[model samples]
Target: MINYISDHLKNNPLLVLDGAMATELEKHDIDTDSELWSAIALINNPEAIKEVHESYFKAGAKVATTNTYQANVEKFQQFGLNEAEAKKLIIKAVQLAQAAKAEFKADDLLVAGSIGPYGAYLADGSEYRGDYDLTITEFMDFHRQRMQLLNQANVDLFAFETQPNFEETKALAKLLKTEFPQKTAWMSFSIKDSQTLCDGTPLNEAVKYFNDDQQIAAIGVNCTKLENIEDTIVNIKKVTNKPIVVYPNNGDIYDPKTKTWQANPKTSSFKELVPKWIDAGASLIGGCCRTTPADIKEIAEFT
Candidate 1:
């Protein structure tokens, strides 16, 4: 199944991943500001989640990332769920995305189980800063159970996204290689700049770390500045031969104090940047924060 998606990427010039799941859910009156973000909607309003996936498909997205970005056991326990129940919700996230894929009935559409950063669970915007303090073993333990359940739930692939540091990325990659070697995953970093990850690791260094990892099918940037994405991809291409995946934010600066995104007047239009990202060798393209289906629709037409 992993090869199925990879083969498509290998044969097609571009594969369109879905835009922001949380932002699209907001249009359905779903609250995405809590610690769980869109994962909260998975419990309170799963239908809305499914609707957002279907909408993305209609907008020409070939991949639907699950709403499990924050649906791990620790966060659910905070919301009064036991370990068993938490695992169910985590698996449910995959089920919801799978249901949407079935309803859409597109053979090419794939479901990517979302694995967000540990800082996302902190709800402090630290995912963009990489201030967490966990050893590789601890990081593996944190992600192991969720990865197991999502793999069992039968997602087409894993999207280990928005990672801020090399440590956690290496941890997760090792976990996948050791425990679920048959599964394919993509690792996307949150960049502080075109040349560095959010934790200040040089982008080329990070890419080199995963360049020969068999479990990682692709490597690139996500939830980064629009202007920085092209340069980031160019830098990554210099280090790895893996297919590149890029899904940048909508050119808004995030304020951790208020947990809001301040719009940037100079934000580039999605239509304008899509071609540049493609020109930079991104095999997969999509949006991150504040992006909508309309943005994806434009990409579908452009590509």
Candidate 2:
């Protein structure tokens, strides 16, 4: 399956990934205010999640990421779900995405199971700063179970996304190689600037760390500002020959306190910036926070 996606990426100029799932679900009037974010919709509004995926598919997305970004056991337990129940929800997240792909009838479409940062479980904006004190072993322990469940659920690959620190990124790469050597995944970081991750680690240094790892099929950035993306991609390309994957936010600031995005009036035109990303050597291009199917449709037409 990994090879199939790789071949497709090689043949196509760009592989279009789906835009934001939680943001799209919000458009359907489904409540996503719980700590689980989009994963909460899995239990209450599974069909809505599937519809969002279908919408992206119709908009020409070849990849649909599962709504498992916050579906880990820790977050589930906060909602009073036991370990068994949590596992069920996690598996169901993948199942919902798979059903969407089948209904959309896009034979080439792929599912990338989402593995969000440990700080996402905290829900305190720590994901953007990487200020947590969790050990590498603790990070591995937190991620391993979820990765196992997502892998068993038959996803094409994992999207170990929004990593903010160099330690967590390295730990995830190690876990992927040591535990699930046959499975392929993309490791995308959250950046504070064009040159550094959220934790202030140089992006080039972080990219060099995972450049040779076979299990990490691609390395790039996500959930970052539009202005920072091109330099981030160029920095990653400088160190690694691996494919670069970029999905940036819509140039809006996320307010964790208000749980809303304050739109930037000067947001770059998706139509204008997507070609710059591709020209900068981005193999995968899509949206993150506040991006919609209409934005994706424009990207599809442009590509």
The residue-by-residue lDDT of candidate 2 on 57-155, one tens digit each, is 999888899998888987888888888998998898888889989986767899998999998998878889998877889889989999999999988
Clashing residue pairs, candidate 1? none
Question: Where is model 2 more than 4 Å wrong at Cα?
Answer: none
Q: Estimate the overall C-alpha local distance difference test score of candidate 1.
A: 0.87
Error of 1 at 78 (Å): 0.5
TM-score of 2: 0.96
Candidate 1 residues 1-303, lDDT tens each?
Answer: 355457887668888989988887888888888888889886788888888888888898899998888789989899888889888988888888888889977788899989998888788889989988899999999899889999999988899999997899999999998898788898999888999888988889999999888778889989987888888888888888889999998888887789888878987888998888888889889989888989899888865
Local error of candidate 2 at 109, Å? 0.7
